[model samples]
Target: MHPALLEIARLGLHALPRASAGALRRYLETARPRLDLPPGEEIELFAPGARAVLARAFADIHHWLGQVSGRVPFFADIAQIAVPRPIPELAAAAAALPLLRADAPGHLADEAALAFLDRLAL
Candidate 1:
């Protein structure tokens, strides 16, 4: 993700109330940085159930986000990560602030998604 977006995510997560979905839309727009992204490259992809998880998290409904979403946790089943270069890491860290630790579970997914976007952007 771009450094600018990372910064946006971090700031928003740390400051904004997750209860407000409207904040998320504004965050997405404000996080947009000027970039010459290449053509034919998919910068965003949503896995099945991603947005619902986000909605629950943002709503502060952790148990539902975990329960209604499934019989068992879906995202928790995967575990594999490779660290990027310092520059990329820095950029990702900045661009992915939306998914910061302070965010609720729903918002957390958004942060995770943005983290992926951060990598692709770089």
Candidate 2:
């Protein structure tokens, strides 16, 4: 998370009433679709040369997930790739977490795999 953004989110977390499940649910329901555009819309809306559209889409999803849930659940849900933010650094960290304790060191050697991992670290 960007330092400035993280700080702002942290402040919001502290200010919000934790027991207000209705409020939280409403917020999330409204936020999710707004964050991720309708499928087939991104490329057409952004134009053919918008090479980074996927990255921006994912980032919004990541931000919304973080806001609705705490960090642990958010990251755990992200591990499944259900909500891809495509932020390089975040993608890198997410990719590594699953392998951190595994003995499968050979997997990271592939050039394409390495490049994918590198993005999560950004």
Candidate 3:
């Protein structure tokens, strides 16, 4: 991971609600690949190009998260898990909502995910 991304992830942990932070830490610990190969061997599997692509995607997601952090009251829900939609689409939907109340329904996340899909087609 890029150093900047690592820093963002570290800082982001501090910003999360306690339960959400703990859940993310636990998930990272348990989701590690069980590769038996030596340290260098595992690193060799990923080409530099592939690593760059992954890093770009990670950065995009983090950027989108930052963009919506203040706007979405239930950001922790989306932050804790990866949404399937593209970041651009997610961002457009989030930007469309004038305000998302703290007590908003969980399904609003879904609605936001689809908000910009059609717009992107234009």
How high is each candidate's TM-score?
0.23, 0.19, 0.23
- TM-score, cand. 2 vs. native: 0.19
lDDT of 2 by residue, 80-107 (tens): 3333333433333333333421312342
lDDT of each: 0.41, 0.35, 0.35
The C-alpha stretches of model 3 lying farther than 4 A from their native spots are 1-9, 34-122
Residue 71 accuracy (lDDT) in model 2: 70
The better candidate by TM-score, 2 or 3, is 3
Please write out the lDDT profile of model 3 over residues 1-122, one tens digit for every residue. 31112222243366555554444344323322321212321222333355456555776676677677754333445432332322232233233222222212322233322232222221
For every candidate structure, what is the RMSD over all alpha carbons to the true structure, in angstroms? 15.3, 21.3, 20.3
Error of 1 at 40 (Å): 13
Query: Candidate 3 at residue 67, lDDT?
Result: 76
Higher-scoring candidate on lDDT, 1 or 2: 1
What local lDDT does model 3 show for residue 6?
26
